[model samples]
Target: MGRKVTVRDKILETAATLFYNQGYVQTGINQIVAEADIAIGSLYKHFKSKNDLLYSYLEQEDIRFFTTVEEKLAQKKTPREKLMAYIDFRIDQQKTGNCTGCHFIKINAEIGRTDDEVQQLVQKHKEKQKNLIKKLVTEIQPSKNNFDAKQLTEMIFTMIEGGVVAATINGNTRSLEDIKKLADKLI
Candidate 1:
């Protein structure tokens, strides 16, 4: 049997979908309350404000994203393979059609700058992602090539992020595929 969904889960789920499909600024608390089938007082009780809900959403997404990525990485034995798995993971996400590119990036573009808390959350997410890549890169066996680990990490991070943005804008995974190919050659 499935676990029962709580009112807070309903609110977050509804808000996440709306915030992803529609802009955060365009989505309102009343809309969330209506869609979530919860009372305004309940939402307020769970989340102090819209910004509070946004933070909660981001935190939830961060956990979900990293957990999935860790599972994906676990399938591969080598650091290089893990890196490729990460790219493949991103590709699969783009193919799913549910992805609004990178949620952190989208949120940042939306109101990250205006909202200091949101901005910090987004920055923290990106830093966590970069650090993951750095960990994998550091695990890679040293090769005869002259590549710097730091530079390689930055390059891979940029390519992956840039590819996601391109794929999102073009509504296709060609950019990600191309990046995967280029990254495979580099690493």
Candidate 2:
């Protein structure tokens, strides 16, 4: 017989889905327990509180996002190709996921100000993303005369974030496509 899924795993999985689909604040422990088909005691045993659960969820999201991106980027040869691949990946994510507008962005907007841990997590994620872009930009432009990798990294990051917000609002990939075109020009 197959091993049964742990209650903790079930709660985390259910919370991830609900938190991603429904907003974080909109999802409650009771709802997670009900959806996960686990007892409240089981949830409390795994996570002391909702904040702890959120932390775990954020960690899971970070790992999943970076792992997926690294795997996709590994397929590209040149830095330019890698950069473009990132843009394409973001666009595809929005298209495939029905344009949820970025889990980090949504969570940050919801709890960043009030929750220091969540805010830090969001900041770290953004910094990592910017660093990746900076590495690629350096390879492509190499900080030559009048070319600033840091500035370009920030610009590209902002464009991508804006594109995601626009896509979510417009319910189409036009914004992401526009960003990709702009990135192509910049790169």
Candidate 3:
């Protein structure tokens, strides 16, 4: 038999589900404890505060998001294919996730300004994503007459971000599909 899940795992798992489905500010510790079926003391034992739980959640999400993206990207043979795969992955996620916006983006909008730690975590995650795109851009278009790899990366990244936001607003994946088409043209 496998090891049983700990109370801390239960709390974290419940928080992740709640935070993803509901807004972070809207998800209370009591709700997490109630859904997790754990004592209030158990949550405090694992996390000092709600912010602490959020921090842990963000860390966990970062690991999971990047790991999944890297795995998907690894399956593609070419840089353009990898980039397209990234866009398609996001589109599929949006469709399956009920059009919920980016997790980090949502959390950042909630507490990015007030919380330095959360802000840093969000910034670092975005920077890493941009760097990955930059690396791919370098591979796809080594030298353009007027545009550098960094500039192209920013444009592509912006398009992807805009696509996600648009898709969320429009309640469809057309924006994401359009962005992919634009990216195809650019590449």
What overall lDDT goes with each candidate model? 0.87, 0.89, 0.89
Error of 2 at 93 (Å): 1.2
Question: Per-residue CA lDDT of candidate 1, range 56-159, in tens?
Answer: 99999999999999999989999889988998999998889544587888889889579998888888888888898888888884464577778878888898
Give lDDT tens digits, candidate 3, residues 1-187: 9989988878888999898888898999889989999899989999999999999999988898899999999999999999999989889989988788888988987776899999999999889889989989899984434778878899989999888888888889999999899888777
Q: What is the clash count for each candidate, in the order shown?
A: 0, 0, 0
Where is model 3 poorest over a 10-residue stretch in terms of lDDT? 142-151
Candidate 1: 10-residue stretch with minimal lDDT: 140-149
Error of 3 at 187 (Å): 1.1
Model 1, runs deviating above 4 Å? 142-144
